[model samples]
Target: MATGVMTPDERAFRGDLRKAPFMLGELEGRWKLESLEWPNALIDVTARDGLPYRLRFDLTNYPAAPPTARLWSRVENAALAPGLFPRSITGSGRVKDVFRTDWMNGTALYLPCDRTALAGHESWLQQMPSKRWQPSVGITHYLELVHELLNCPDYAPPAGA
Candidate 1:
């Protein structure tokens, strides 16, 4: 046996989620993560923590690096409404796939592992204090860089063969 984690079903599920069309686009660039106001609809749930809200995006198609973002609830620091705020995680990996809870009622957030070391990073984030859970703004200047790299209009052919 290989002797490792992940069963057949779990593996299949992971594959399916990764290939899912939920996260479209070769989204690569610097992104800013802004937290949305908690919807008033959750007031009836009677939870001991603040409502969750977040936004997510991909930041790999850019030039700088890979990045990701998330927003969590106040109580126990759970991702009540997390967004896939993509940026750069080159040292880690890139954002391959993302899945969030139902609009604002769920707490579970899922993102598929790409070339980025997201699983490890996420585990590290879990140990962080709740107060650190603040909105973020990721500016991927790489987009401009990419444009320059791909579509530099001032180009000339070589002098000779």
Candidate 2:
């Protein structure tokens, strides 16, 4: 475990991790947690198709404030053909376009992990059957949700699809 002074919530979260070793093992098998801060955890998980991906979880206000998940990867945009000179020299000019050229490197998606009303803005963790999060729900439930999300067709796009 990472050593440092922990807040009440952080302590609770750690307790959850300890209480559910099996669940933790499942997550570890899939998304290996690399590091853990009081409010942040860095994890590397293999996509269903075996593509490795990194995820950053912001658990600062956890429970009350859903952890924010960001896809941290430098995937080359397949939409752009190889050797095709980018129309925008600085890459900034392509910001208006639907397909981002700079997506070849840096963050790709800002997952909405909250229960927002906006379409496509809802998170699997905050969706049906799993949306009933309570104070008692611990890291196990969250990890299970992550597992489901990684396997769900609607949540996780088919590899290279």
Candidate 3:
């Protein structure tokens, strides 16, 4: 959905998917650190399935009104230190900009975090509002909503749905 049309409340409630287990996949490999762009971050892509590669202009963030998550992927079998994932730029607070994902550079999936309330709703509510729940679900929500949006049987918009 366009950022302008989807109310913050609607955006919050759009996805209802459940969280999947963190997949430790082919992304595990040596990747280089690049740079950070405001909407997009930068990281060097070392290997997709063990070949040299990199994506300079391609990175993604969450779709929430105020996105909170940095990019993340899983790396396996590579020799780095322990406690490294959290310490990596893609992990916790080391720097807001520089980061890396655990996954290598094959099929890249950028997922967003739920940090802001539904767009059109107030930050807080006194009673359970009659409008769409506008509640926050995690990445799963985005996944579910993406599926729904893709296979929408009825092209009708949510009617106070």
Off by over 4 Å in 1: 1-3, 25-76, 79-161
Predict model 2's lDDT versus the native.
0.46
**Per-model TM against the reference:** 0.19, 0.53, 0.22
**Deviation (Å) of 61 in candidate 3:** 10
Give the per-residue Cα lDDT of candidate 3 at 33: 34
Tens-place lDDT per residue, model 1, 1-161, is: 35456544334323422442211211322211232221110111111121112223233322123333333444444443233222122312222122223322322223312114344556534654331222121122222222222223332111220
- Model 1 residue 3 lDDT score: 46
What C-alpha lDDT does candidate 1 achieve relative to the native structure? 0.27
Superposed model 3: Cα runs more than 4 Å off: 1-117, 123-137, 155-161
- State the lDDT of candidate 2 residue by residue for 36-106, as single tens digits: 76687666555455544455566665666555444443344122232221122333332112112244332
Q: Look at candidate 1 and tell me the lDDT of residue 90.
A: 34
Error of 1 at 101 (Å): 15
lDDT of 3 at 128: 31
| Ranking 2 against 3 by lDDT, winner | 2
Clash totals in order: 24, 0, 16
